[model samples]
Target: MLIQKSGHIIVNNSTNIYEEGSIFIYWEGFIYGFNQQSGKKTIREFFKNLQIHGFCSAISKLHGSFVLVLANEEKQEILVASDASGQMPIYKNQDMISSSLIELTERTDLNKEDLSLDKAVEFVLTGFQFGPKVLFDAIEQIPPSKIVSVKKRNFFLINRDKEDDPFLRTVKHDSISEYLNQWEILANAIRKEKVSIDLTGGTDSRILVAILNHLGCSFETAISGQPTHPDVIISSEIAKHLNSHEHFTSIHKVDEDTLISDLYEIAKNSKGINDFVGMHRLFQLHKERAKRGISLALGGGAGELYKDAKQWRCALLSCNSKNRLVDKLVNTGFVGWGMGSQTPDQLFQTEIREKSANYKKDTKKFLKDIFPEYHKCDVFRLADEIFYKYIIAAPRGFSPLMFPHYSPLLDAAFVHYGINLPKHLRFGHQFYREIIAVLDTKQEIASLPTTRLGMTLLPKRIIPEVLTSVFLNLQKRKTTISLNDPNLYSLLRKRLKRSNILKELVGIGLLNPKIAIDNIPNKNLGRLVSLWLFLRILDKRKN
Candidate 1:
């Protein structure tokens, strides 16, 4: 399912290629792809017909993810193309042959080196690599919606200018009524086999469920954590109200035994430790769903599309208010929950100021690159543009995991609708209020669920007062209890001595210098200690 070239690998399901479906073929000293459509018979036939001298094109018009490579035998050249939105990864190194010749040997017969250390660090910092850069230095991933050609060792890249094409049509809508009408377009976009909904007691998921229900689509719902967990209880209630079947699961503490057994397997398979915790749980859940023959799953993964817009409105309000907005924001959430004795007002201020400064700088650059003509737009407009470019589009990486995973909210139509809404309609607490209203009007919720498992099953009174104290301190600063806290350091050291989990955390913390430095005594060593213990478990498994 995975093929590697020059340290980059492509994943695909080639064994079962349906007629009129997409297929990845490794042939003629290169990779080739054929997409079956109205006029095309086989991919090979298409390639054969388009036999231009000293050049070959690997056209990938399929709906799924793949890398298409075309090599001209006479010219000894190769051309590659990848799907739009970067669903597939295609990497190349211009110096691969030379590098391989120098480094390749019997012990290391592989033709390429792993991702570069600097690139990998950058990925850790940014979450994803931008442009042609990968986690490796010499190797470069081909950008999505692009073609890379090599003719007699001369390289040329051509990007599909979707934004510049005048012939491409644009859909225009008027007022909220037209926007609401587009819901049908969104509903029709949901195409999958054995669909399941990751239902939550929230508005986004509720709206999706209602829409799907209206369309007469059949779907089962799945919820995670104990019955006491807020999402679980709320989702279960919603499912019941909707008269739908549901599956629920619980996740307790990730203990030493589980970490030790599963860490290495996960790391080896995934190739990195970023988001290791969440990914582990997701993988388990995905496997479980896969067993039931569910190839496609839907969730409120893009719920943030609407919710975050509302948050931005609040942020803007705080920015304009005489009263410090940070204080108000901090007080409203879990950040206000007291955990430590430390006064974090100054730290919080500094962090927010730094972030604001960074945001402004980045927004300026983004505007210059993406909307040079819109130079006259105000900060608010620029902010909206940045949001669409960064946050809304950033999570596409998580989408392909569905394989055939389909997210109604993330669908093209839904996103277009969500993005073009008037600023007045897009911002403010009313955004969420409207969604909640829709849920209630649609009767998308069942009953309220209980609290988290740890909170409900574990006696709150018995829980260490220090933990609460630490949390309070973090809340005061609008931050989490970090490893640098003395209390957390002492706790982790004690845990390390007594628990294998703590030992493993220490090991991983040591390996990742950033993790170690971030938890250095000044920041919050206690929190670092806890994270280190987690990392230790991860490290042990990786080894």
Candidate 2:
């Protein structure tokens, strides 16, 4: 058996090996096999002219995320094949070792002298890395669906293409009744699995629990929040109603001193910037569940499933004025005022101009594909791009953790179904208002049971307006913006003033510099507010 680059490979001369995450090597006299699971058939038969017989035929028939290496150790020749998706990476460096050193050298580093930092930065900013580039210069991913073989020092490329016979899109249902029937199919899928769900007091997760209960699935529910947050209360109620064991944790008052330590641990373990405090708690939760023998955890991710993108589409349909769409976009939460008050049109233009050449190309193609009727609008283009990349991918990445994370809402089947449904059916006439209504209906899941306890911090709602006002005021500008009502402004101001650490960090300019530079009085002043607040909690924990 040979293990290379975090995968298992076995050389067998006596038997036929069949297993997932396992590799089989056929060699002289006997067949050897390695598998993560136990008691698999190792060798089945022997035949003369084995290389020309069923050996190659059987090898070609195997399908999975794996690599196969066939060798006639007596004849001293080898062939290697990889699966279609290349979900399991396989790489070989030729002439780096002799027969005597083959056992010692499990993997070889790739030369990355041509690695591009600019491309890396652009990819990271877009929220996903692409192609074969790894963080390490010496590493490269094996491209999906490729076959490579090595015999002595010579290498051969056998197959390189996407999987043929792509899965067909299934859309047999036409009405809400049919959609409900499809939902039944999905609920049954969840019921058949040993599953746990991250149940926030939100419409999405609540709907999932309701469906699970209807399907007669025995599931466990987990919630994260401050003790008194509305979500905790609602999730607890739903869990009790469903008769599912409920686990709730208070994160609002998490020890400040421990936050930094945990952050460091998270940084070491995580792959991307999108990971934040919530993930750390999730990791701990997974461990606890694993100890109790749970294997699958479900959550309602993919904001599109619950939040209505159809709002933008509806606004586009009813209103011919671009300005109206812009206003509606902001009110509907399409434009992130927190990021900046750039109008939707302006944000669209900036992103189109600045993002990757590939992204621009893809956006142009997507615009044509999704909105063929309308002349190209920067607003629609931008919304579609951001919706798919940042908004959709963030929660999807959670699926790859050590434990399987299942989100039926994000399931391709469900998303495609929702996309084709009429806007009225999905979110009703006034989109955002309708969404809030839908959310309120599932209020049992939407309320948090407790407030996050820590150094008092500005309420999330007022930060944008306060920052905008502070910036405008410092510039000697008087703007009558009714957006920040007095009561909310005063509450946020008190929270800001009370957190000396946050104030100091914000003064230094760290949390989100671009936001600080544009909104704060002093550009560099808010450097470490979020980080410092996070670290201070960690420090207190140690003390």
Candidate 1: where are CA atoms >4 Å away? 1-11, 16-84, 87-90, 95-132, 145-156, 161-171, 174-192, 268-273, 304-311, 314-381, 391-404, 428-543
lDDT of 1 by residue, 429-460 (tens): 23434443443554234223212111111112
Query: Global lDDT of each model?
Result: 0.41, 0.40
Worst 10 residues of 1 by lDDT: 98-107
State how far residue 313 of model 2 sits from its true place (Å).
Answer: 5.9
Q: Number of backbone collisions per candidate, in order?
A: 43, 51
* RMSD (Å) per prediction: 11.0, 13.5
